[model samples]
Target: MKGEFMSLILTTILHFAATNIDDIFLLLTWFLQRDSKLKSSHIIFGQYLGFIALVILSVIGALGALIIPQEWIG
Candidate 1:
């Protein structure tokens, strides 16, 4: 049971890291920029909103795939 729990935790972390790797670089760029007007809170909030949008779109796409006819796809 303990090993299974640890594997689940590790899988979750890896999946999250893979999904957000691009976001990590984008955030780094935002932080490194000088003379930028954006505040930290604003950047964080924007990132959150973008993530929410992606998740919503992903769900929609998954549902759409299920609804789509396989013959139509081919």
Candidate 2:
């Protein structure tokens, strides 16, 4: 049980990092830019909007995967 739990946690972390690595670099670029017009609030709000959209899409995809017949996928 503990081993399974650990594997689940590790897998989740790896998947999350794999997916978000690009987002991390994008966020860093946004933060490092010196443009006076680009406010931190704008960057933060955009990030939140993007994160919410990704989560919503991920949920939909997971639900679809769960509902669909496996043989149909092949």
Candidate 3:
């Protein structure tokens, strides 16, 4: 059971990194800007908020698809 849980976590991390590879570069650039008004806290908060919104929307859409008919989806 423990091994299965660890494998699930590792898979999730790998998939997340693969899909959000661009976000890594984007965050790096934001941090590198020396004179920018954006603080690290602001950047971090915005990223978290954006990710949460994405997950919520994805969940809602998936649930909706399951509730709706296939003919209506097309």
Using TM-score as the measure, the top candidate is 2
Candidate 3, residues 1-74, lDDT tens digits: the string is 99999999999999988999999999999888735578888889999999999999999999999999999999
Instruction: Write down the TM-score of every candidate.
Output: 0.65, 0.78, 0.72
Question: Which pairs of residues clash in candidate 1, taking residues 3 or more apart in a chain or in different chains?
Answer: none
Ranking, lDDT, top scorer first: 3, 2, 1
Off by over 4 Å in 1: 1-15, 34-36
* Candidate with the larger lDDT of 2 and 3: 3
Local accuracy of candidate 2 as per-residue lDDT tens digits, 1-74: 99999999999999999988898889899999937899888999999998899899999998998899989876
lDDT at position 24, candidate 3: 93
After superposition, the stretches of candidate 3 with alpha carbons farther than 4 Å from their true spots are 1-13, 34-36
- Checking candidate 3 for backbone clashes, the offending pairs are none
Best lDDT among the predictions, by candidate number:
3
